[model samples]
Target: MISKISSQRTRCKSWLLGGLFCAVACVAQSQAAGVTWSSQYQDRLFDSGGGVLDTQFSFEVGIFLPGFTPTASNVDLWESNWRTLDRAYDPTPEDPNDGDPEGWNVPEQFFVGYYQIEAGGYSSSPDADPLYAFPGGAQAYLWVYDSKSLDAPREWALLTDGITADNLADAWVVPDADAGSLEWYLEDLDVVIYGGGNDLQGPGGYTLDPVVFSLQTHSVAVPVPEPGSALLVGLTLGLAALLRRRGLSAARG
Candidate 1:
């Protein structure tokens, strides 16, 4: 009985210690980054749009790590943003007008996703039918293709944006030339993430937050914070650590 009890106690301690570290680290990191994770929300939630509560959407977004500070040598990381969400989705025409004067049409230049998904019952003449890409067509299914990268032209993550034209969108994610040689998101001299998706399925048709990245200090437990936010977090955490030590010592006595 004693052996069994001791084993159970050991497992309990292991779980408690592991859980605490993980929870603390995750919470701290999220706070430090202040990332706005991509998620489906009712258009009405933050809607300045008409009162429609459109809830369905597939979305992706990314923020490059602040200054590309951590693990700068990662080529794939350099090519892509620091964090991204390219959820798979496809738009199908289910309305009476398959794809014409009344669906969703934003110009090709505005999309954040690098690729596009053509909706069901697509029209050949995109110029005339500038509205819904698909009208009353078929059930939605996800399909993807690489909008860029001719060398490795494979289907990237599929998106749920409604029907769109096949032509590629104009590039907008230009590199900041002033960010020094280390910065690669160059608009003029560089490449990658050139264009984006536009005409969002949601009501507002645009992001509610600005894109930004937080620095990471992996060697230290505390995630690096934005310029003014770090000092307060550090002081509070230090005080908590001191109290924890005191409690542990008292328990031993």
Candidate 2:
């Protein structure tokens, strides 16, 4: 009877140790497989006269990836706008209702998307080299209408293959990295606004332009242990403690 009891205790300890090891492995796997890509937009607005305005707008979005890492060659081609809540608008001195002044709300409804273009295809100007020269030949862009032009939406739609504000609601979907032509990934992102100057007239005859536009991208890893794994670890430890108490009671008996 003594030998049999000893063998049972050894088996129980071995099983408890195995359960602990499995719990640790689960946490390590989650850390290695989960990654999220994030993009941020920042801009400083100025009046047509080049005086810095009190208004500012900034936005950020995050895309989750399971078992994936962003690389220049693995980026996908896609376009979509983030949710309205992701858009940040500061109060402008000229317009109290919305930070943006009348006839100058272009940034309020811009789209964020990725496109693949030949090297130097999308230059700052007709004579300038490409604004972004990524190794994998892909670029990210923010598509917005001209704030001062009455026909800006139509012109923007025509340039972007019929994408307009009317149809933007349907295009607001989470991007699938594996669905499109894999040309590049979010290893790094840089966006520079060109051509348009801070000369557009805003409400009350106040002209405004984006004097500073900056885009930044980065990746974050989120590792959370699975609930099941945590429960299993807890149960194993509890059972080991119970067994020890029972063993001590048996010896006393």
Candidate 3:
């Protein structure tokens, strides 16, 4: 009778341990099934004396994959426009809508992640059609201000080489005479941008263009465990604890 009871206790413990492992594994597998691509931009304005201006803007975009469908609740987007600057420009006597002062040109920057997601459904532009780039769609694209030309007709160039889902974290050199560099990576669950080398000098100082900077990254999305899975884990733990206590009590008896 004593040997039989011991074997029963061992079987119970083994079953509970196996249940706990399976529950945890289910949660891990759910999270590893998909990838997410994210991007963000921060634009800072400065006065001619290098004083930081009151107006700054930032925007963010997130895209989850498996299928590039927005209806899948895979795309998240938001932007903060220049409200103060827009208000300041609104009250101007001439070109009231044009608040941007000369030489403080808002550098044009674009990330392909935004374009791809928007082109998937969020954008109304005819070019937004995914099929528009049929036959050979781009893996990624970037538009950066021309560092060589700070004059009129500010040129923005499109870069493609070395830019892809797998290579987003790499510092990509801007194809220009100056060969400026930029990087995109994930931080705190968001993509952050860091780069410089544009010739245009704003009030903030030279060598760095604070007018606009962007970062992008692609990473696997971490999924939350289902309520049922969580409950199972909790119950398993409770049962294991109870079994442990009962076994101890039986041994003492």
Which has the greatest TM-score? 2
Candidate 2 lDDT for residue 110: 25
What are the clash counts of all predictions, listed in order?
23, 3, 3
User: Against the true structure, what is each candidate's TM-score?
Assistant: 0.18, 0.25, 0.23
Q: Candidates 1 and 2: which is better by TM-score?
A: 2
**Which sections of candidate 2 miss by over 4 Å?**
29-190, 193-208, 212-253
Tens-digit lDDT track of model 2 for 1-253? 9999999999999999999999988754333111122222223333333343223322222221233333322222111211111222333635534634222242433223232223222221222134433222122232221131222111110001122244312222232322233221111222222212122221222233343422211111123467999999999999999999999999999
| Runs with alpha carbons beyond 4 Å of true place in candidate 1 | 1-59, 69-81, 90-150, 153-193, 196-253
Clash pairs, candidate 3, are: 50-203, 193-214, 193-215
Cα RMSD (angstroms) for every candidate in the order listed: 27.2, 27.0, 27.7
- Candidate 3 local Cα displacement, residue 5, angstroms: 2.9
Question: Highest lDDT among the candidates is held by which one?
Answer: 2
Q: What is the lDDT ranking, best to worst?
A: 2, 3, 1
Model 1: which ten-residue window has the lowest total lDDT?
A: 212-221
lDDT of 3 by residue, 1-253 (tens): 9999999999999999999999988754432111122232333322222233222322222221223322112212101110100001112224423444321212322112212122122221222333322111222223222222232322222223243445545332111112223343322112122122122221111332444422211111223567999999999999999999999999999
**lDDT, residue 151, candidate 2:** 25
Query: How many angstroms is residue 48 displaced in model 1 relative to the true structure, after the best TM-score fit?
Result: 31
lDDT against the true structure, each candidate: 0.29, 0.31, 0.30
- Least well predicted 10-residue stretch by lDDT in candidate 2: 152-161
